[model samples]
Target: MRVVSLVPSLTEAVALTRPEVLVGATDWCTHPAGLDVARVGGSKYPDLARVLALRPDLVLLNEEENRRADADALLAAGVPVRVTFPRTVPEALTELADLAGALGATAEPDWLVAARRAWAALPEPGALRRAVVPVWRRPWVVLGSRTFAGDVLRRLGVANLYAEDAERYPRPDLAELRARRPELVVLPDEPYRFTADDGPESFPGVPCALVSGRHLTWYGPSLAEAPALLAAQLAQPG
Candidate 1:
């Protein structure tokens, strides 16, 4: 069946499923490398006209990266769209499994079993850590509660200082970080490009680590790598 993936993660899944079947994709769907498809556009503003011309049987989407009006337009045109939004890595694996099952695809990744086993072996943080998984530098968007980063950190025993805050990605003053004093700050490499060194300069003595944006923040095929990646981060000798 011909498929069009507007979301980067779902587009990656289509590539994982069968490259030949992916008739259309966005520019950022570059996971497998050499994913050759007409670059319709980015996730936020897909080339709706180009996508409609693809004559696809199914269009893949993600609630996080897609706009409500755009999806409504596709639905109005009588195209079947499947949406997936994973809060954690395991959920992403499940979504992949479900997508594969629906598409009659073979060779499902062993993420479901491995992810749980790896997560179970993870040690917990007994107290709060003043880490900021911020997405941007100027405006400062953080990895707040209800997101994959927050959930994974919570499971591993670390807590977000802004967990009690109202906004998910609130802009906080430097005083907040100083007040909470995170043991080891974690920053995502993408969106904000915040590195471990950036942490030391901003919040001195707070041993920090630049986290893989996809593993911690992305909720797609990348989820399969979360448990082990997180474990390695946690296992680092202080």
Candidate 2:
């Protein structure tokens, strides 16, 4: 089956499992480097005409990574679209398993199996440390409540300072964020690249954990090593 994926993580999963099935993907789908598929623009605003032109049997998307208007447009054009939203590691694994089934896998793929084992092997945290996770700057947006990234950090023993906030992603002023007095600031390099030089300077007193956005946000094969990799980063001294 020909597939066009707008979600980067899903694109990686599908590409690694069944590369021939992917005929198109968003330019942001950077995994499996040297992927030679039609670029469908960005995940948020893909080129619908180019996507449609691919004549894919299935268009894969994530509710968080893609816009509803694009999904609706595809549906209106009589194209089949599979939308997924996995808010936690287990949910993400389940989504991948389901996708594997859709891809005609008789059993869970190696990466999926390893991911399940890796996450399951993580020991429960003794105490949860309070942290403020910034995904974007300028306007300053953070992981609030019910986010996949927040759940990932929770599993790693870090509690988001704004996890109780109503908004999934909240725009809080720098002063307000600083007033929270978090134990640490977890910075992932995506949506906005938070480098050691770029992000750590903002929080003078707080230690910052610069992490890989792919591990923190994406829900595909990265799940296998994310727990260990993120743990190492979170363990770094101030």
Local error of candidate 1 at residue 122 (angstroms):
3.8
Native-referenced Cα lDDT, model 2: 0.92
The estimated TM-scores of all candidates read 0.85, 0.98
Q: Give the distance in Å from residue 119's predicted Cα in candidate 2 to where it truly belongs.
A: 0.3
Candidate 1, residue 60: CA error in Å?
A: 1.7
Worst 10 contiguous positions by lDDT, candidate 1: 109-118
lDDT of 1 at 6: 86
Off by over 4 Å in 1: 110-117, 120-130, 196-199, 234-238
Worst 10 residues of 2 by lDDT: 229-238
lDDT of 1 by residue, 9-127 (tens): 67776676666778998877777677788878888998899999999888888887888888899999999999887776467667878887777766674544455566667666566
lDDT of each: 0.72, 0.92
RMSD of each: 2.7, 0.9
Candidate 1 — what's its lDDT? 0.72
Q: lDDT, candidate 1, residue 212? A: 71
